[model samples]
Target chain A: MTSASVDESTRLAMYRDMVRARDFEQRAYDLFLEGVVQGTTHLGLGQEAVAAGFAAAMRPTDMTFCTYRGHNHTLLRGAPMPALMGELAGRKTGICGGKGGSMHLTDVPNHAMGSYAIVGAHLPIAVGAAWAGVLRGTDQVSVCFFGDGATNIGAFHEAVNLAAVWKVPVVFVCENNLYMEYTPIGDVIAVEHPAADRASAYGLESIIVDGNDVEAVHDIAVETIERARRGEGPSLVEAKTYRHKGHSRADPGKYRPDDEVAAWLERDPLTISRRRLEADGVAGDTIDAIEAESMIEVDSATEATRNAPPPDPATLMTEVWADGGSEWRN
Target chain B: MAELTYRAAVARGIAQEMERDPNVVLIGEDVAAAGGVFKTTEGLFERFGPNRVRDTPISEEAIIGAIMGAAMNGLRPIGELMFSDFLATCWDIVANQIAKTRYMTGGQVALPLVIRTANGGGNRFGGQHAQSVENWAMAVPGLKVVAPSTPSDVIGLMAAAVRDPNPVVFFEHKKLFAAKQEVPEGEIVDRLGAATIRNPGSDVTIVALAAMVSVAEEAAVVLAASGVSAEVIDLRTLVPLDTKTLLESVSRTGRLVTVEENPRLCGWGAEITSIVVEEGFWHLDAPIVRVTTPHIPLPAAAELEDLAIPSSEQVVAAVQRME
Candidate 1:
């Protein structure tokens, strides 16, 4: 409905981004099982559409503040697969040189403003970036991504209210995947719609969309991001979706009913996007090639990351300050 | 040279930086129209305007979070967290988010930010409002902790903190707001991690910070009457600590005494004494002494608070006891 519509080429690009995100997450999950990736990782296995759609709608100048489950968003924002995987594996060739690990993937040049692990911490930081645009008279927007659990936190309300009053260019996107860590989000949140329902309190329009639908998510994102750039103020969007896998590594997700899991799996975001691509008269061979290419890229990225060396022991003593060294004394 | 108050230097220092750069902004609760809770930023709102000088809701997390974000982007934000004691509300933003972002990002983020708070006691604002938390910031990595004693040092150190390519928590002592000094005209910028020797002597080395700096100075005068010449050193910054200056003075004087307003355990004095014991062990002619507040919440009553924080008499007693 907006002037900046998604054309045919853009559609193919979004689909390709979705495919790559899926393949990359699958490979990363397998690596986690093999213990090649240490610590923990949160994946967007069934929630790839939100990242692909919103990232596709955003400009390169606009910044992104995503949560810990951020591999899909980072890749969709144009970060190389190898660098992201290398970061997950804690290698010297990682995006942050093995400093950030998986939960804090950041490529500032690419506008991925790091993935924060805390529940509602980055919301205010995103508002600050947007406030910079208003002060500098720039058109750049700041996009913040969080889970359903973040809506209950105090920082979320503070950031949203401040953004509305300041009329800063920030679009807060909440991916409501029905659960926060292990508990069902619905059991905790009072309102039916977590993010969009609270938008009214901050004087923002309540906009909720099917996060599983790439086009639906992209359309709302384009509208809100443009609205922010035009100085109309912030918007809260709730994208209803589900996580195909558990919250973290080793969460089999046995809490959900078997029938519910089957029903949701049938409506996978990748499948929905692929189906729409076919309905749009795209050649079957073309879709097949895109999928194959994504698999090859993920395989290659995994191989390269596995072959990479661990970070230098000296790096532990570096980067504590801007001087590029951790020396506190002369 | 025009005499200036310690509180006025805060506004002047921010004004200098705001005039030099359009990207430098001030955001906090009651910072724009009402100046600030402590009136430290009295003139900044009028001079910088509302866009650059912003007032926020009583949201400490949002204020600090926004500062971190703006710093990472293009803007250099100077956040005023009314009272330093209120840092407990948003410690995650300061300790976890902004502090670790640069190091975790592997030098990718240059968070050029300054958090100026009304720090320390001497007011009847009670324990919740009048805590000296420079030691809290000193314990965290990637944070440059600064607390100035004099009005001129306030302006100079504020400029240095604003210009630094990292995050600096500039603590303006609440007790020293009315303290006056003949500050020179024109721009005055000072370096971080440098200690100034307030009074030069060779008998004993007395180190102190912020409000305690003047207490140590007064104690030096008292010790002088008793024929005990004491050298007083004001530690302007705590993070990139001036261990060189401290070691040089301790090596010459062969005695070290620390005067701190913070509680006994894990104060900045502990760090200083540990360094002296490790590096300046042979230089010591006697045991190093630390004059600090008792480990308890500062009371609102004048009598109780006077007994809690480190005073000039206590510094003199602790030093004479060292002899």
Candidate 2:
């Protein structure tokens, strides 16, 4: 029922984040096609609103654990553009110091623990982090972001059960983009609405919102995050979103129908958010300036990362063990 | 030197570590006021308080998962699963997460965690509690598995494992916990992945681990009286196995006898025997003799349990077969 007390500048900031995520992903996809980036990528093309909404509501002190399609999550969690671009370019200045590629990006200082490649593996990990925060009497809430495919995993069930039993302050954000890779969720599970039905099974409150609407998604996230900080236990917020690109770099998404894609494209999150600002009496020049500034920032980061050095061969064995003052391996 | 039981040395090591590091904490069922099912964690709760020595619910998966999370946030957690056989309940956490986290993450993080559990089948705790499951952990890539046989070895290995960066699985023999030995007075640290020669001889080489080490040593004396000198090598750690010492001993003796308290099929003894055969193939005079438990579940009765596990008589017989 509550909405965020957003000002003109705050709305523009949210718009810029969405634009940056969208633009960076598009450019990365182009580079991936040209053989500049080596590995396959799962771009966050149409899911910018989910990241922008949640990241806008959360504090830098709060922790976030994400899945493979997590480039936007890392950027929204305050990972510098240079470091993020360096990781994609496989440079030493990357967030994981060029160790982790696109699938595993981490910036611990920003409280964004790396994304896990395994399906549903990070669920129990996030639950444990939230439990630690609660035991330490810290009001810091941990956010776990996963796709609809992860819901079918056993680790997801075990993690949700533990989180519910302990009443740990965590937000389980499921970015339900209708299709889990190629198989639609409707064909897999018997339940009509995945999050609404499953959340109640674990004794948690559920909220289903229009994920394409940035203002609505942001307001709902802010409320749920506050509830968690007040020790009111965990909540499941299922953002009904869609992806414009294929599952990975190789997939052309021929499995999905053309009319379905067109229908969702008409309700794009970025277009809707800007139109809402215009209707609310916001000036047009301010919005255009924000978009221009974000493009310049993204271009600078891309150039810096390309020029950064590759990781040293000797650095491979550094983080394997702690410096315990004993030369056991040498 | 001071005389201390193997169990006492292990308990002292844990208590000393907890007292030294504020980040070090222990979690297991019956580890608190009950002082662990084997009394290894005795008086720790009184000294360190409940926060440090926590009694977790009977969920092995949760215990390991929680420790992994704590370790990620700069806390050193020691989780105890009462028996090695019960590790099956949390195999996913151990195999998938704990073992592969470092490699899959491209070495971005180090798991500073220890899982201490009792293994080997000498006690009459039946099939559920008595089992030697060290080989399962040995098959895993990233985990470091260590099994110590004596009081002094237990103290040194425990301290080393606590300070190790990678996740270590410390397997303690339930039968050897009450056995007394001369231990060093101060704190001692031993390097892992090294084998110790308990008894030296020139006729034949007998390789053993955990509770079987004592039996191998006893059999060596019996073999000497019969004019068949047998050397005994205690494989202290299983994963980073001491193939160098094992092959060297076999090269000198030209014969081998592998002894273990676990089942014969695919046991840790099989791994050691394979290494000797592959590395020291030309040095072998006869086929490698394996003295191990029958391929069956451990029995509950004292008499049946004694028959199920390998003894000194079996080791002596195996040495004679090599002749």
Candidate 3:
């Protein structure tokens, strides 16, 4: 309602990004099962819309901070598929040079700061980046992607208060995926609306959107991000969605009712986007080609990452300090 | 050379850095307007203005977290935690984020930050407020910990800390803030990982850290009168320890005594003792004695507080035991 209807090409692009994120996460999940990936990975399987939608709204100059389940965001931020997967496999050519596994992904050139493993810890850091942008007098907005669990942490309140007071250009996007790890947010948080209900306390504009609807997310993201870029201060956008996969590997998710899971699974973001694309006069063959291309991309990335060389032991002590201070072996 | 108090020297050092680089910012609780509770950052608020010099809310975690983020974003932020003891409240930011950012990012980003804090137990601040907790930072790999005893050392070392490529924790002892010394004029930056011999002697090596350096110096003067020649070495930085200087002194003296305000268990002195034993074992003619606070939290009472910190007499006794 704030702007013109999203074009057909942009709609197709959103669908494609969603498909790409889905394929990458599915392949990464398989890799985890096969023991090819070293540690556990938090997958954003059912929550792809928020990643693609918000990423679509952001400019190349804008910086992004994300949570542990951040591969989708990283890919949309311009990192190559091979590099991200390679990092997951602990290869030398990984995004973090194999130093950081899945939880820590940084693509500075692409403006993806890093994915923090700790919940709510990176919010303040994101505010700092936004403050830097404000100090430098640039239109760059720092977008912080956190989960529902982060809202309960002290850092969430501190960062939001600080950002609101300073009126820094920052967008706090909470991908409220119904649960925090294994625990449902309802059991933990006191509020009925986690992101929207709590916005006014920090003096921020709150928006609640169907996270499963990629187009709606895109529209709302575009508005909120523009508001931030215009120096309107920080805003909280809660993308209501659900995760298909468990919190981590081996979590069969026995806590949720079977009917609830089934119902949410039926409303999968990818399926909705695909259906919307077809209804929007986009050819079925074009959507099929996009899905097939995403599969091919994921396949090649996995193959390259599996074949990539492991990190050299000789280089293990490097990068601890930029000044070459206190090498681990030295 | 102008004589400045240790507190003034630290303030001047930060002021000089701010003048040199516009990107250098000071952010902490009570840093602006109040000029810091310790007054170490006095006059910085007025000189740098509120933008460069900021007074943050009493959120230690956010202060450090923001500083780390600002550093990564090409701003050099020097945040004060008020007391080194509050590091307990914000250890995660330092341990998981600041200490590991560069290494975890594979040198993709350099965090040029400085955490200036007040340390030591001589003040009647008691338990929580009066802990010399440099050992907590020394345990981390990426962090560089420097504690200066004299005004000259603080001014020079503080300048080096701000300009260092990595994150540095500048530990200023609470007792030495008012202590005056002749500081050299102009910009002076003492290199990290370097040790200076306060006094040369052939009998015993007295290695002291932070405020203990002065105690060792005093003990050295006392030892000289008793015909016990004790050499004093001031360890300016704890992380990149000047082991070569320590080993050389221990080799010449054939005796070692370490004095620190921290407890005996797992203290900075323990790290030095282990290093000496591992690398300089052959040079040691006697057991390396450590003059450290007894393993206990400092009590509030005046007498108990005085009893908790290592004294010049304790350093003298440790050196005599080493002999």
Could you say which candidate leads in TM-score? 1
Runs of candidate 1 exceeding 4 Å displacement? A1-5
Better of 2 and 3 by DockQ: 3
Task: Tell me how far the alpha carbon of residue B192 in candidate 3 is from the true structure, in angstroms, after superposition.
Answer: 1.0
Put down candidate 3 lDDT per residue, A1-330, tens digits, no spaces. 321378877778888898999999899989988877778788889999998888888999899999889999998888899999998888987988888889998889899998999888899899888887777776789899999988999888888888888787888999998888888998887888788889989877668999988888999888888988888898888989998988877697889889999999999999988877777678899999999999999999999988999998766878888864445222
Q: Candidate 2 overall Cα lDDT vs. reference? A: 0.82
* Residue B300's lDDT in candidate 1: 96
TM-score of each: 0.98, 0.85, 0.97
Could you tell me how far off, in angstroms, the CA of residue B129 lies in candidate 1 after the best superposition?
0.3
Residues A215-251 of candidate 2 have per-residue lDDT tens digits of: 7788878888898888887888899999998888878
The lDDT for every candidate, in the order shown, is 0.91, 0.82, 0.87
Model 3 off-target regions past 4 Å? A1-4, A324-330
| Model 1 residue pairs with clashes | none
TM-score for predicted model 3 compared with the true structure: 0.97
lDDT string for model 1 (A1-330, tens) is 331367878788888999999999999999998988878889999999999999999999899999998989888898988999999999998999999999999989999998999889999999998888777777789999999999999889989998898888999999999888889888997888889889889988999999988888899998999999888989999999999998988688889888988988999988987877788788989999999999999999999998999999999999888879887776
> Interface root-mean-square deviation for each candidate?
0.9, 4.2, 2.0
Two-way TM-score contest, 2 vs 3, winner: 3
